[model samples]
Target: MIRRWIAVAVALSLVGCGEDPPASPGRFGEVTSAVVLVNPVINQGSTTSVATGGERSGVEFQAEDLTVATDSTGMALVEDLPTGTVTLDFDPGTYSFQVVREKELYDVVLAYRDGTVQPLFPPVRYPLGGEVVEVEPGESIAEAAASDDTIVLLKEGTYPGNLELRAEGVLIFGAWSPTRGPLSVIEGNVTVLGGGNRMRGVKVTGRLTSNANTFSAAFSDIASATITGNGVTLLRNRFTAGQATVPSSNAVLVDNTGIP
Candidate 1:
């Protein structure tokens, strides 16, 4: 009920000046007495074999009775919040978060909706002997994969075109923003024909199709995924399209949120 009023007040603020000034959230208390900064982020390690990640951009949530939104840097400043034990409610459709009090401040941590923090798992690191291939946005991921390198690192940017991996045992790691979502986004479809491949911290805006080669993805986002390989694994992933096809007898899915 409180959030609904806040929404209506916010809507009124956007109207042209002919309307009366909207009521402030400060009606609940002194809006200037206590100002707090909130950082809403997606913390990694909520799923299997995922890394401790970074902050998101442009997120919105509620601080006490007032609705606040974060900027592109994923930080918001809220004034007039009651000093003690303020309750925060996040949008349940997008993420699961919990508020942990420290001194007079609060730390928002991502977890299950039940307030259960899942155990953290160390992310996959680059191998010692394998060649490391680095690619910037607009560069060819396919070319990097063609090098048959052990690791392909995508810097923070968008890559265009489809990606097909035929190399065996390759690991693709992308620059990721935990709370803001994927930093490295692939604009086209991804086809994996290679065996024993792993991908982490990336977002594929297009569909993903994998053949008989075993594949695993952690902490990533895909529009849709189709796996025909045995022993495939998907952990802590978000499928925006809510479509996934995996052989139940051979695939493992854990702690993922999206359309079923």
Candidate 2:
């Protein structure tokens, strides 16, 4: 009996020494961290180039109860963010900004909080042009365009899965010739992370996010569009459902037909 009591005591001690039980992740899943990069007020207008000054400071970052201020480098290391907390509110004294949580890092962009759209990702600078690659339906859009290839021409067919634009200045067109059939279809959500990208003559059946800078789409059909980039223009495009958000003063929606 004494040995059993000792054993119970030892077990209890071990339980106490062990790390506290992990907090429940809730419906959003495990908590994560993202590095938030912010540009200066002058650089905010240009996603591709940095202005005379470095990254700006004094930006307010808030998620839940956690609040942080950007350091001298205009960057904030935001931690303990729920995976479901895809968007965080940021306010620079001069302009309102939105911080989007990417898979690995956070992207900071100028946005107005009108309670219209959700946040997404940001871009890395790539060259303005690259070789064109032809992609068939059912082929991987991510794989069809290599790092060096920028233009992705989709033949008349459906591309599946969550599509991404990783290369800068990429053009994903439906490849319509004089003999036009149906528009090429992307049967998944698209997350754009490259700067100066364009999409034309395609049908996106899922939500579309232009997270990079200077994204333009023309004559395409999108279910929904979340424009997070600067200088984003949606022209002559049609939307089937959901809402279209143009929070940036630089973003333009021209002659677009949409049910939503």
Top lDDT prediction, candidate number = 1
Instruction: Show model 1 residue runs off by greater than 4 Å.
Output: 1-126
- Global CA lDDT computed for model 1: 0.54
Tens digits of per-residue lDDT for model 2, 1-260: 00111211322432464622111111001124444445423312222332223335765756556887766645555556543434555543332233233222223333222322222224221121345455667888887654633555566777896988887766665743222422688998988888877776778888998778878776577888787767875644677784766544665544356522
Off by over 4 Å in 2: 1-129, 176-182
lDDT of 1 at 42: 27
lDDT of 1 by residue, 57-158 (tens): 544556667787655643455554443455445554233223221111121333222322332322122232345555678888877777443566666778
Q: What C-alpha lDDT values do all the predictions have? A: 0.54, 0.52
Candidate 2 contains a number of clashing pairs equal to 0
The TM-score values for the models, in the order shown, are 0.52, 0.47
